[model samples]
Target: MLNKSEISFSFVFSIIVMAELICGSVESLSTYHYFTKPSILISLIFFFWKHAQHLDAKTKWLTLLALLFSLLGDVFLMFVNASANYFISGLLAFLLAHIMYVLVFLRKKKNSKKVLPFTALLLIYAATLFYFLKAGLGDLLIPVIVYMGIILLMAITAFLRQGNVTKNSFILVFLGALFFITSDSLLALNKFYEPLPFSNISIMLTYSIAQLFIVFGLLKQS
Candidate 1:
């Protein structure tokens, strides 16, 4: 269980992340990215670090590996507007992070009872998304297809843990996966389709919340 100190630190960090995101949403305060994004990543790392002593070596390593790639994804995407390569690199990093999360979730999966329903849900969501985005994704067709498959697989695996783990644990991770899907969908739509008003705020908020839910859920299992 998290001690008072850990809880306080996590709370403070979360607030900082929120403030940074809010500041970033406004025109003049965009410079806050330097502090906000890194702090968000660091908060996650610190949370895991504090709890690492309680986890198995393999679990510790895998979780940290996932977070590391996520940090890289954040950094790469920061420069996405400057170069297409940066966006591609960011996508690949996040894809690897999702793969790691899938592995982590599968390791914790103790029951197969819910797999079919989860698979069906993921398939329907992916199919609908692809249908809408396919026309605009001309050059990115193959990459987008592959990314969608991986993320959908991640979501399915997350839901499959429902009956296996504690209800709270399952719900947190499952919701994290769902928020991840929402965040990525909005991101793609904004970049490849049409820009939504305040897209930056929405994307960062959902993305931050998704990471926090997953991290806290895994930590709770400790």
Candidate 2:
């Protein structure tokens, strides 16, 4: 494996390229977006490998799989303009990713009633979002509802980790989960509700931060 400094350099380079592709509106290369959009997840996966060498076996593999699925999700969504099928595929990929995350967080489960209250909080948020999104969802109503449930469960699991891991790990992972939810909520609203200014930049920025926080949190545990 490369040293941390080497990995950091490569990761930063990839992100800069991605930002240029997104923000600069470069149209020189048609295939650039294909590689650039998913580059963030690719780099983060490498970063995870470098830092998680001693991580618990279950959490290590599960988190890695989750990241991989998220990368697929990013790639599939890049072609949303071409076909609606791509968007569904991307949703499926992210659903799987969240499932993987839920599994990883569950490995260190602790019995705490405090986690129950969070379930109610998350449900309320999901319910309110669904109320607004239902009409526009059309045929996607069921799929979107299921996706909401999974991601909500994913967040609940992260909260459930509060008393189970290091404070640094718990706080970072929980924050990351919230950021992930926010990013997804933004994407859904933009696509299903109404367009938001700078939706591309806003969604990707939050998504990138979400993945970083989660990866770093797991590294802390390692």
Q: Could you say which candidate leads in lDDT? A: 2
lDDT of 2 by residue, 26-136 (tens): 566556667677778888888788768788888899999999999999889988899999999999999999999999988766778997788898888998998878879
State the TM-score for model 1: 0.92
lDDT of 1 at 59: 69
Model 1 agreement with the true structure over 10-62: per-residue lDDT tens digits: 68877977887777776687788767877787788887787667767776778
Candidate 1, residue 135: how far the Cα is off, in Å: 1.7
Model 2: runs farther than 4 Å from truth? 1-31
lDDT of 2 at 98: 98
Clashing pairs in 1: none
Q: Lowest summed lDDT over 10 consecutive residues: which window, candidate 2?
A: 17-26
Task: Report the backbone clash tally of model 2.
Answer: 0
